[model samples]
Target: MGRSPCCEKDGLKKGPWMPEEDQKLLAYIEQHGHGCWRSLPAKAGLQRCRKSCCLRDRQVKNSLAS
Candidate 1:
């Protein structure tokens, strides 16, 4: 079976995330934990896909590890 789309393509933000966007995502996950990737973006008020959030989270972790 084909994979389901991570998010709706229309009107969604693409490319690098702004610092504010990263902050919002980080704050939301800190408060609520990583409940659900698919829904977290909407809950966090981000116009990004769940995959983007996951990737961003990983990037943040990697940066901190360095």
Candidate 2:
């Protein structure tokens, strides 16, 4: 059988991120630079999986640079 989807496994959150979640991620990334997307959510106290974090990082990275 095919492996289960990562988002569906382990009860990891899936869907739009909350404002507080974004703020938490932004602050974490700003302070720690998101060294590894795969390991970032736990470090940042997020319920989302790494892919969600990765996408959010992409969205904010450019703005953060400005």
Candidate 3:
């Protein structure tokens, strides 16, 4: 498959997310639940794709266990 675009420029708030960013994303999902990833980036103020976000969460979980 072809490479995808960088996780920025598309209006995503690139770089690392602050604690508030993480809280907001988690809170939104906890209250309302997940929606389409294509729309979630903008809605959640995240510059990452749904796929990237999913991967990041997975990595975080994995790291915590070790």
Task: Give each model a TM-score.
Answer: 0.86, 0.79, 0.57
Ranking by TM-score: 1, 2, 3
Q: What is the lDDT for 57 in model 3?
A: 56
- Predicted candidate 1 versus true structure: per-residue lDDT over 2-64, tens digit per residue: 986765688889888899998999999999999999999999999999999999999997998
Pairs that collide in candidate 2 are: none
Report the error of model 2 at residue 32, Å: 0.6
Tell me, by lDDT, which candidate is best.
Answer: 1
Off by over 4 Å in 1: 1-8
Quantify how close model 3 is to the true structure by its C-alpha RMSD in Å: 3.2
How much does candidate 1 score in TM-score? 0.86
> Which pairs clash in model 3?
none
What is the lDDT for 65 in model 2? Answer: 84
- Better candidate number, 1 or 3, judged by TM-score: 1
Worst 10 residues of 1 by lDDT: 3-12
The sequence of per-residue lDDT tens digits that candidate 2 reaches over residues 6-56 is: 688576888887889999998998899869988899999999988888888
